[model samples]
Target: MTRAVVLVTGPDQLALWQPLLTGTERTSAAPVVLRRHDRRSLRGWAQRVEMFHKEDRLERLHELTGGWPLLVDQAHRLHTELDDPDEVLRRLAGLRTDLTRAREFADAAGVYADPLLAAGYRELDKEFADGSFDWENTVTAVALGGELEEDDAHRVIACLDALQVFDRDGVELRLEPLLRECVTLRT
Candidate 1:
């Protein structure tokens, strides 16, 4: 027997792959979700792109991106193309100080360009329109006083995860800092 491992990656895995797989195939498939890179993996990616010269700058990149691959790649591209990459990183890292600056950075990064992420953002924005959500709270709180069924809450959480809007540590879910800033600023 030949054994093969297939990896499926996209903004929405279910939407991308579900239609093609039969019910038994879907049930038998073992899915492994890939999360953001860590410092080590970030270093590896940076080295491959020949952007690993400055230790401090690399650390700053890690901090700013939280290992989010798209943001990291964007930062790397800006780093290579721009005369002063530090200034760019500095501005993005300091977005918390100015709402306008945050919006500009978010726009430049094409944060909502991905359809799945845009949909997730819209869902989150609609759910937490007041811009007051407790990150430490469970997904049940996302339902907002039982408005959504338990399955709906799970689906929402799954969608957010697929969009990389938040990081899940065991049972806890914390929104990505940069995304949180952008979302809150928009609200």
Candidate 2:
């Protein structure tokens, strides 16, 4: 028997890929689903990262980037880029993950010509201003706030996911507190 394992990061990607594998499985005609890990898994990842990098800075990296595999990979690169953990973290903390990420997503999705994504992103920026951007309420908040529709919310969320602003889940969303600080900066 042949088996395939796919790593899906967010809802949009899942929607994109799930259709392709609808009936390819041998025994079962249903699509296979896998559960993602919780934040607790970060501890083990932190240890592994610490060992690999030979830097006792995974905890700090996790504090900044969270446990998402991609973010961890970025952290690893950042680890190689700088000698001091404090300087590395300062660089990370100074990033505008929101803006840069939005641009990347828009470019990737070929939506740079459209203002909808930018407008939706600004709505999210406003939402993150005084309080938190609730993952669960993201669509509703943006829709109700007249920034975007539910469908557009998915696109915006996809952008944010790519940027590591929010870790997307089916029913709930998790925010990386450190990056969230960058998103919600008042000044």
Candidate 3:
């Protein structure tokens, strides 16, 4: 008799299982990391949006989103409700403070249901409200005078990255311009 139990977390279980279960005796499947699109790749994604084939519009979208795929996808989804794609794209680009839009993003991104992530966001939100966006310091504060371990802080930061709440390049962590503006307005 054999018993097997499988536990999976996150939005994509297949993304986890694909590499782990595909290894053979002598060869292992190469891991694939799906990164957010950069400007050039974002241009390609914009072009694929139905009826949006103009180069100038694509350029505008690229400039607005800074190559963030979720922002690009949100703009693409706006075409149906609004008459002018360009106008709608512009609004979506600048509408981060809209409570409705924020809730939509949180829901779609699954951050709304996560208490740990919510706490982290609250801490960062307070820092943003205070005109200081020092994420490293924020992480340290959240960890409570070294009470929490470093790995836990890293995991929180990683979750924030996955939520597109901010960008991390090596040691530098900064909020996206739009998110900063939104936080400013709310405060």
Candidate 4:
């Protein structure tokens, strides 16, 4: 007899997998969600692909993609196709802008359709609207807002976590670079 573990990956959308994996199935399969790369890991990925970019340019690429593997691969492809580095960044910026707009539209539609989701979005939007927040302060504000019950707050936080909205550093949490960019652009 042989034992093996299989890995499956798909879009970040959890709703897509809900129907396929029931409680028992999920318990047996034990799905493990993978997060996007950080700056260091993304740099390693670029090196593996034989893509060498200057530090500043690479930093910008990380900012644009939030180290998402697919977007990083797209950036690599664009870099190979374009002769000018500046042009590559410019093109990536345009693509990121389009993606951000599409996400905004989708989020708006979702908020309109679901009250709980709307509350989460509102809390997030209000927190990050100023482009700065102390993690503790933000959490306190959300908990004390009086609009969201404790369970609702937990759900909202879990939903945002599933969406990869925050990067955790030790005890602190902050928005991922790309999400911060989107918030900045919105304001």
Query: lDDT winner among the candidates?
Result: 1
Q: Which model, 3 or 4, shows the larger TM-score? A: 4
Clashing pairs in 1: none
CA-lDDT, candidates in order:
0.60, 0.51, 0.58, 0.59
Better candidate by lDDT, 1 or 4 = 1
Cα lDDT for residue 160, candidate 3: 60
lDDT value for model 4: 0.59
Ranking by TM-score: 4, 1, 3, 2
lDDT of 2 by residue, 53-133 (tens): 334455555565545455555656876777565667666554446566534433433223235444555566566543554
Best by TM-score: 4
> Could you list the CA RMSD of all candidates, in the order they appear?
5.6, 6.9, 7.2, 5.0
Model 3 / residue 70 / CA error / Å: 4.1
Show where candidate 4 strays beyond 4 Å: 1-29, 95-115, 128-146, 183-187
Ranked by lDDT, the better of candidates 1 and 3 is: 1
The residue ranges of model 2 lying beyond 4 angstroms of the native Cα positions read: 1-39, 51-58, 68-71, 78-115, 128-137, 147-164, 167-187
For model 3, the superposed segments whose C-alpha errors exceed 4 Å read 1-33, 48-56, 59-70, 80-83, 90-94, 128-138, 145-147, 179-187
Cα lDDT, model 2, residue 49:
62
lDDT of 4 by residue, 56-161 (tens): 8878878777776656777788878976667777776774467566466334323323455445645666776535555555555566663766654655555555
lDDT at residue 25 of model 1 (Cα atoms)? 40
* Residue pairs with backbone atoms closer than 3 Å in model 4 (clashes): none
Task: In model 2, state the lDDT of residue 155.
Answer: 57
